[model samples]
Target: MLRRLLVSLVVFLVVGAIGSYGLMRNALATPICYFDSVDEVSVIGQTGHIHIGTLDNVNAWVGTYLIDLDFETAYDVYDGRYEGYCIEDIYSPDNEGGYALYDAEGSSANYEAAAYLFNQYASSVSSNAERAGLQLAIWEAVFDYGSYNLTQGNGNFYVYNGYLSSAITYANTYLNSLNLFNPDTFNASGYGLVSDDNPLSLDPQCYQDYIIANPIPEPSTMILLSSLAIGLFGVFGIRKRLLRG
Candidate 1:
């Protein structure tokens, strides 16, 4: 009876190990692909205000802003005023009755706020190259925020709002704590695209293309591997016991 039990245990463990290994192998072999050939120009030129369904949609809006505002002014305004507003305040259903950005009936307060800030600081920018660099940085930050929110949940306004608030707090604290905005200490490329041109034109689909190129590792791969290891260990231990018996 002892030998029979050991044999059965070993068989069960072997089967489980095989199953887990198969799953892991399958997961490893199949790579998930996202938007690869998305046209950057089309993405940037999109003027129709709509809900952000994907990173592409967000990119389209960003592209529009890039075209509309000078890079330096856009950067200063976004960096300064982004913290003052929340995604919830910008897109909340309550504001749908009034003026809103993406909603049907409301006015686009978010764009207006950014524009106001840009106009306020536009005169301060001296160099076109510097402005372009700053614009890229702002775009990258916005893209990062939009991408993160999308991952939390597709079209989840609450998640996006909370994330936006937290991101602003974190960025402001980090920038202020170190007083790191000086040109000598700052690395603008780390933030976004840098260019020598007066107005930087970004491919509308660049963000989505980037996402497709860099696929995050699936969490399930680790779980499957762990299960496989446990199963193999169990099988090995049971076989050893059987041999002793």
Candidate 2:
């Protein structure tokens, strides 16, 4: 009986391992493609959370952020959806929404600037004013590129609330301090795009700008690999016992 059980277990694990690897490739590849159904906006001293339905036809929890990343649906979408694009898509050829970047084009500069801005100012966002300011600054980074002034214009974004002007001004201070919008000093391979479904089919500027970081789904991957190792170990122990018996 033990021998039979061991054989069945081995078969099950081998099959599971294959399926898991495929899922991992789809889930981990291309910056983890997702539809991002939830849109929880950030409030004063409080951050919003969102749930995602990944492209693998699996609904996985990505991460929690101050503002949800989406192309169209607006629940807590910092501002209304506008025609926007982030970085260059070097990962997915079909334009599946979660593509990677290399700081190559205007889109690249937009996201690179946003990445730099987020790296600098995202940690100090304690108040809603600071939150609003940081978000406004990110928008400015994506839309206007090198410009720092937060005034509304023909092809630029203004502060969502007139009251949050100082917060934005404060946000711009750090970017000015660094002075590298597309700073090639650090690696941006971990950053990926978060856009609507098939954004490339349109003019590529008919959606809100958003990005999905890489560290979000790491824990689940670790867990999957660990389970496979344990299963293999158990199979060997069972086979040894059966031989002795």
Off by more than 4 A, model 1? 1-202, 206-244
Cα lDDT tens digits for candidate 1, 127-227: 43323222222332233332222223333221233223333333333223222223332322111111111122122322221111011233334445566
* Prediction 2 global C-alpha lDDT: 0.45
Q: List ranges where model 2 is wrong by over 4 Å.
A: 1-31, 41-107, 152-155, 160-162, 197-209, 217-245
- What shift in Å separates residue 93 of candidate 2 from its native position after superposition? 24
- For TM-score, the strongest prediction is 2
Q: Which residue pairs in candidate 1 collide?
A: 40-203, 40-204, 40-205, 99-106, 99-107, 100-106, 100-107
Q: Which candidate number maximizes lDDT?
A: 2
lDDT of 2 by residue, 89-155 (tens): 1112222334322121123556666666666666666665565556556655665667666543323
Backbone clashes in model 2: 0
